[model samples]
Target: MPLGRAGAPVDWLVVGLGNPGAEYVGTRHNVGFAVAGVLADRWSLPKPKSRYRGLVSEGRTGPGGPRVALLLPQTHMNDAGASVG
Candidate 1:
């Protein structure tokens, strides 16, 4: 459906820790990524992409016009420690 109206923009960025590999899709090491996936579903996130070194999705939600960016890292599982700060 088309958007009802454009309101004041509010943005959010969510980072999930994980390795970027089909092999690690549901492994224990991807717990954070799992959570992010669930959250993205909740907020109706757009398709994930590889731009910016990992999977990224973004969109707006809610009456307050909340914009959100959700990221699942591509770094190796062992070195998953960085985030947008």
Candidate 2:
């Protein structure tokens, strides 16, 4: 994935804080996840994978030439990084 030229190579990992399950998927606290979804759509990205209590996505967010691999980690609000891998 290429999120446009970063001018410099950057390994970006965008984390969306939220709890597990469908119940908490759309609460106010999960706005990060919602925004991340918009970003994914705007960038023509695909759905993420689910595992370890979180949804993960890997893709770019920019035009041609060169881009960056943007990561969306939809982990719970607390201990979000616990399931990172």
lDDT of each: 0.69, 0.59
Query: Model 2's lDDT to the true fold?
Result: 0.59
Q: What is the TM-score of each candidate against the true structure?
A: 0.70, 0.63
Model 1, runs deviating above 4 Å: 1-10, 78-85
Candidate 2 residues 17-54, lDDT tens each? 55666887679877877777777778776667664456
Error of 1 at 21 (Å): 2.2
Q: For candidate 1, list the clashing residue pairs, or say none.
A: none
Candidate 2 clash pair list:
2-67, 2-68, 3-61, 3-67, 3-68, 4-67, 18-76
Task: Single out the weakest 10-residue window by summed lDDT for candidate 1.
Answer: 1-10
Model 1 score (lDDT): 0.69
Best by lDDT: 1
Question: How much RMSD separates candidate 2 from the native structure?
Answer: 5.4
